[model samples]
Target: MPPADGPSAPPGGDEVDRIVAAWRRVAPDLDVEPLEVLSRVARLAHHLDRLRRGAFAAHELETWEFDVLAALRRAGGTHELSPGQLVVQTLVTSGTMTNRVDRLERRGLVQRRPAPDDGRSVLVRLTPAGATVVDAALADLVRAEHRMLAVLPAGERRALAALLRRVTAPFETTARG
Candidate 1:
């Protein structure tokens, strides 16, 4: 079977031509739209993955490492959080979180410490070295993101973000619940 979202041939020319013809017949007053904007967004995200891989590679960090490290960095001063907390922030399974923490600890980037009030639990705290790497990586990542957003004016970028948030808000709430 053809993919559900794949373009159908136009009736007289190709899929879209057919779609327009049918629309014209069924609803003469309605507009038949171009799919360019949404299509481009999807295509651009694919290309952006390549650019991101290069950016992460330059820092000698894997994408997974950046995900985990950035979550810790965003946890405010001292950059300490429990493995369970990291799992929530990063949206990874508990086993994956444990593995990431283990690898980072081995590299001396973070360490596991007893939770202050919970004897059976441990917190993952960024080491001085981890903090140094995260800070540098974040600076570089910001520059990369800025480069990607340069095509849009500041106001346009803000508007786009607002629109995207509106589109995604329902899904976000559903996921959280």
Candidate 2:
């Protein structure tokens, strides 16, 4: 098939295009329009995950390590957050976060200290080394993503981001736990 988007679609078509074409042939009654957009998003997500892994690995960091370190780095000012806050931001259970913090602490990437104002509460702080690694990983991740999005003009990228936000907002609001 020539694909749905006419001249704008890639001349040779992609895997999603082929899948849509095959599905159409078997079930012509169904509307496969959604696949053209969502399937591409799914594939892009897979590729992005790989890029993230590579970027983190280059910094000698694991994905979860990056997540926690990045969260702490983003905490500004003191570069620290209570363990509970870290759990929420990293979206992990307290036990998992505790183990991660322990591992990271052993590597000198983070430290736990009593909250200054609330001695009973403990806070996880990203060490300078952790900040450096997370920052480098973030830069690499952004550069890779920019390369992938280079095919689109700025305006189109903005428009696509807006469209994706609309698609994602509901799920984010509901599925965030």
Error of 1 at 122 (Å): 0.5
Whole-model Cα lDDT per candidate? 0.80, 0.89
Candidate 1: RMSD over Cα atoms?
A: 6.5
- Write candidate 1's Cα lDDT for 1-177 as tens digits: 334544344434544455555666567787655433454566677877777767777878887898888888889887999998898888889999999999999999899999989999999998888888877877887889899999999999999999889978998888667
Mind giving the per-residue lDDT tens digits that candidate 2 earns over 1-177? Answer: 455543223467788887787777778899999999999999999998898899889999899999999999989998999989888887889999999999999999999999889989899999988888899999998898899899999999999999999999997887574
> Model 1 lDDT vs. the true structure?
0.80
Best by TM-score: 2
TM-scores, all candidates, are 0.77, 0.87
Candidate 1 global TM-score: 0.77
What's the residue-level lDDT of 80 in candidate 2?
A: 93
